[model samples]
Target: MNSEEVIALAEQGILTILLVAGPLLAIALGIGLIVSILQATTQIQEQTLAFIPKIVAVLLGIVVLAPWMINHMVQFATEIFANLTKFVG
Candidate 1:
């Protein structure tokens, strides 16, 4: 493929990745921030205290978002595979 075509494909891949990951990452970030505040206030100083909640929140967000994420990924993969000849040739 030409440089423009390759760049377009790369951009598409990046956008797909961001779209798929943004929600879960945002959830984890927000939860982590909250946990940090809580720890600072309580002076508990437990690393796992923040870690577990962030992990669980991220997991739950993933579970809730799985269908949409899968659909986006499947669509991207299908388009890439279907256009394989165009990309290769």
Candidate 2:
């Protein structure tokens, strides 16, 4: 493939990664921020205190978003596969 095609493929790969991971990451970030605030206010300095909630939040986010995530991934894969000849030639 030419440079442009390579770049386009790279871009699509990155976009797919972000689309798949963004929600779970955002949920974890939000949960971590809230837990940090609560810890600050309550003076609970246990580092592990934030871990469980963040894990649960990420898991819940994944569970809730699994179908959508899978659909997006499948669509991306389909697009790539549909263009397989172009990529190969």
Candidate 3:
């Protein structure tokens, strides 16, 4: 396809990726921030202390958000596939 079409497709793909990943990343970030604050207060320098909560939060986020994420990804994929002819030709 033309450069404009290719760029549009790339933009859509990026937006889809961000939409799918944003929540989980936010969860991890929030958990990490909290853990950091707790560790600072407690004077605990254990790396696992920081790592475990972020992992758990991200997992829980995934579990909770899976359906929504899947729906968005499916919609994006469907749109891309449906427009494949236009992209290719």
In lDDT terms, which candidate is top?
Answer: 2
**Per-model TM-score on C-alpha atoms:** 0.94, 0.96, 0.96
Give the residue spans of candidate 1 off by over 4 A. Answer: none
Report model 1's TM-score to 2 decimal places: 0.94
lDDT of 1 by residue, 1-89 (tens): 89999999999999999999999999989998998998899998988888889889999998899999999999999999999999788
- Per-candidate Cα RMSD to the true structure, in Å, reads 0.9, 0.7, 0.7
Stretches off by above 4 angstroms in model 2 are none
Q: Could you tell me the lDDT of residue 29 within candidate 1?
A: 90
Candidate 3's residue-wise lDDT over 1-89, tens digit each? 88998899899999999999999999999999999999999999998888888888899999999999999999999998999889788
lDDT tens digits by residue: candidate 2, 65-85: 999999999999999999999
Could you tell me which 10 consecutive residues in candidate 3 have the lowest summed lDDT? 47-56
Candidate 1, position 39, lDDT: 89
Model 2 vs truth, CA RMSD: 0.7
Model 3, runs deviating above 4 Å: none
lDDT: worst 10-residue window of model 2: 54-63
